[model samples]
Target: MKWFEGSVADAISSAQQKRCLFIVFAADEQPASVSTQESWDSDAVGSVASSSVALKVTPGSDSYTQFTQIYPVTIVPTSYMISPLSGGPLEVVQGTASTDELLAKLQSAQEKLTSAGSAMAANTAGAAPAQASAAATAPAPQTASGAAASTTPAAQQPSNEDKIAKARELIAMKRQQRQEEEKQKDLDSELSRRESGKKLQEYKAQQKSREASDRRKEMQREKDEADRAREEIRRKIAEDKAARRQKQSGSAAASASSEPVSATAAAAAAPSVARPPSLPSDMARIQFRFPDGSSLTEDFSSTTQLSVARQFVADRVSDRFPNGFSLCTTYPRQELTFEVDDQTLQELQLSPRSAVLVLPKTTGKQRRGGSGAGAATALSPDSGVWKIIMIPLLLLQAIWQWLTGSAASSSSPSTPAPSGSQAASQPMPQASSSGDAAEARQRRGRGPETGSSFGVSKEGRVNRFKPNDGGDEDDDMGTWNGNSTQQQ
Candidate 1:
């Protein structure tokens, strides 16, 4: 489509002179307009439109204004085909069209233009005779009346130039409206984007704060648990210490109760001994544990003689151990006998807070008794001595009873009487047998009735003795007895 570079009126005059169809293309910068232009420029459509006079008109141009007066373009990319003879549109293609469609439209417009030209020629030849005949029979016209004839004919209908101006105004108004709409749409899009971004930032901040709060709560919970664990440990430690202290106090009280009153009174009445001038004035506190699980505490000057300490203990336990007891220390175990008695407590390092043990002295007689025949004689009924004596005696008694089963019955008065001498001799044997039976009964009675001699009897006379280095010893100094010395 080679568009003629001329004004709309000139293009129409040229089409009339050439006796061809006048083509007008109206378009804008819109994409549909460009597509339509391309279609028309193609070889197929261009070849078909080549014989016609083609004019291209865009918006806001003089040619567009001139063309839109007769054909107001409501949509862009419109094509108009005007007849050269009639100067009226023959075909109109609105919006974009394909190459084939454009070709068909051009062909149709050309046929219409050719038909219009033929009609005009036929009408011209026929109209010449009609005019001659009318001239031959018609009368001359009368002149118009004075002023009415002079007045201008009634105002003619609006011309093409007026229509073109109105179309231009409309196009301008629509273009302004489209510009305003695009501006408003852009503003709306920007505002929405900003609002969304703000919401996202706020959500992120809230999530971060929530996470931090959760972390803090977890830390606090862990700390609380740790504190509880530590408190439980501390409570357990305190309870154990209290239990130990109570046990020690109970034991001390039991030991003190078992001590002799006479010895305790004597100890209380004794005067405090003077200490050596070289020693410090601080007193030493000593704890004494007796063999019976009893305990006592005493205070003494550091320089006081060890003999005085020994005397103090001696007086308290004098009745229980007439031979006296010995004292010893446990840490660096050493006996505190008469040999160390003359030494000052400080010299023996028995100062500050020290613990001593009271062990009963072992006498020569007690040791001898523990190791010798006296020990065997003093044994309980469960001892080997009692087992040896009782088992055989029991067996002998059973045998004797079996053998004498019918002797007494057979010796009845039924037999004839013996001589007087024989009878006197039989009486001596009977007396000896009766005496032996009495001795055996006495021995059986002396033995413990129950299995264990040390066990308590109905009389509550069971004696409990401690084991010594020499083995077992009697609590009494005189003789063995199955009774406590205290009970005796």
Candidate 2:
């Protein structure tokens, strides 16, 4: 069977599923000249992984971290056999062993487990019969409540036999009963001792188990600290490497830019026949294609500086692309690294027939503080953010419109029209709706009666008097206009 290759946890799960021990450890370093993978691939050791799961571990890898902590592995190629049931180490097999011996060891462990289980089961079965038989043969015990008790009359029993003979008999019986009581006490004491011893053993077992768990946890904590240290080291190394690469790129760019007419021009203009045969010199021509499909060709010395090539290509399309550009190869295109900028055209190793496409320079600015806001461009005012910003203004505008509409409706006047010639003397036929007349009366309560702005109340009270309509004008009020006002 093929062994499943994964982390320590996966190995444990597989072991539990298969009901087998999980073996976890790293293999010894093989000699550089060694031809075979002897530990896992060889036929001799194949069966070892077939039976129990094998987990491979690296010193710094997270895989099998718990295994390394729980089992001390001072030597390489050490193996730990862990029980699937308790998830604890069952045995540690050190060094290498022959295939037969390894198989024998595994077989022996299996047999021992099987035999122990059988022996326990047999002992339990045997004990059950014995207990049942003893219970069946033993008489029922008389408890204090079930026993028949009798009282001596007048608290005295003196004359049943001759006094001396009865007394002697009673004394002998008392001595025998006392001896039996002593024997029963000795038996009870022995039982108590055995029980106490058993309890002590159980407590010791629990204490040991607790101590083992504590040790495991401590080991795991140490391993975690070590892993974090290793991670920090790796991060530092990576940072150092990146810094070196950046430094190299900077130095090269500085030197290449200082060259007046870089070596590329000489290599390109020099005739190939004049070059030495051993140098494998060739005149390579490159065409830089733009996004618009219009391309420009530049004949450069295969040893040309990237900056020279960049300047040449930029000159051809300088009108349209004044901002500068980057050159990349096509067919699984990749932008050329600046590290290659200072290198000769020969170092770049472009095939004589290959072409480079000119790409626009990336328009990204360095942020000062490295904040997200600085790194990211603020969205355009016409973007979705602007739409969200306009929501509140739209709501406020709508609210203002509603408020003005409500004020306009409430402040509007609803005065009644004058009925036929109230100005001329006839009190025209009773008037329109009483509702309008009632509303006019309510309006009069707020302001004084005036001539230009006037109304008729429900009581036929006119706000203004027509001077010639048979009515008298009181200071800011009206007179009765229909009948007796003129006569008075």
Candidate 3:
């Protein structure tokens, strides 16, 4: 016969109060070689096994005589265990299976009595009664297998209270671990949020700088546009002034062209005005009245006619500007007449056509003054009586030419000259006398005899004058004649 057997001879007691046994029979019981591995973890629960061996039980074997050999008892605690097939922890026997030697003896005796008949062979059949008497007196060895069998029934089952208590303790520990993990996660999330906020602030600052740059560009563009507009207005103003000057020049030229054509058909144009006449010192001091009923009486001793008048108008008008002044006319309209009491003159309003009667402010034989009537009579062939007579004569000749149709025939450059007709018009004796008189005047170094003599030598050139040709005696005689004629 055979029996699986193990003993405490090679067992080690762990700090956890558990036993680690080097198995002697585990491989025989399962028909496979037991693992020899001693799996010692940090927890120190190690397993070991020996090679499979057969357990012998004959009439005189150690297993049959020793009552404690086959049925030795051990203690176990309430704990869960790992199941091989289920691959998880399972419930364990809870209460300690403490074995009392007396109780084990009594228990083993009963089992032996029950199994004595089966154990006896024909040759040992006579020993059955002696085995039965010994079994009744001595107890059996109580091992883990026997103890589990006796207590697992409903009447003798171990309580589950200890198992429940251990399960609750493990659950509490797992919950605390979960809480710690959650706290670490929260810390990580907070760190991420702070970094995001920093980046956002930097982005906003960059955006503001971009906006400011755009505004600067916009302002520069506006300034350029404004400068362009000002330049355009200035150009237009210059163009308008130039156009006015050209128009005035054209009108003056047309008037000169429309004047009478000479009998020789030479172009007869009006002479330009003489340069401002040099008057005596007494005539230089003149005064004028403004249009605002105000009089400006000042010494024009060193002033020109236009300059004196302009100064007076500027001074007078500036005073009235708070009320306002019109600039449409070159000169204002209110006229000024001569000879009034201070009160009346002060109260008078002058018109634009007002004439300053240039009379001698002082009178004596030695006083310096011009003969006004004679001076007026000295007007050039372009003005006064000469102009009046020439215009009528020109009109009559033009009408005569048109009626006779001689203008086309006789006016041509290639036409034969009328010998007597031209000779009668220009007498040789009078022409020769005029030439001799001009030669005498030249030798005396006289000034120009006519206003037409003063002129520029060429276009864009300075004005020049040819000296006069009359003697002083002749000049004085002419002056006497002019004064006597004015008296008549």
Best by lDDT: 1
* Candidate 2 C-alpha error for residue 43, in Å: 2.7
Query: Candidate 2, residues 73-173: lDDT per residue as tens digits?
Result: 55466556565644444444555644565556656655544564477578667866765675566566576422322222222334535555754565456
**What C-alpha lDDT values do all the predictions have?**
0.70, 0.59, 0.37
lDDT ranking from best candidate downward: 1, 2, 3
**CA displacement after TM-score superposition, residue 476 of candidate 3 (Å):** 99
- Give the alpha carbon lDDT tens digit for every residue of 1-488 in model 3: 12235322212112013311111111112111212111111112211112112232223344334522422212111222221111122222222222232124323433443243245344255555655575556555479755654443433322466545654565455345545655776788788888899989999999999999999999999999999999999999999999987987897788578875674334223333422345454343334434545544443333233433444555655654444322222245432322231222112322222234222123433333456645655654434565544554555544543433232223212222223324223322222354554453333222223443331121122122322343243222222121123211
Across 56-168, the per-residue lDDT of candidate 1 in tens digits comes to 99999988998877567766888888777655567778889888888899888888878877886897678667656755565554565334333322223346777567656
Per-residue error for 141 in candidate 3, Å, reads 8.7
- Rank list by TM-score: 1, 3, 2
**Candidate 3 ranges beyond 4 A from true positions:** 1-164, 252-488
Error at 53, model 2, angstroms: 2.2
Which runs in model 2 stand beyond 4 Å of their true positions?
32-40, 86-90, 116-488
Against the true structure, candidate 1 reaches a TM-score of 0.29
Which structure is stronger by TM-score: 1 or 2? 1
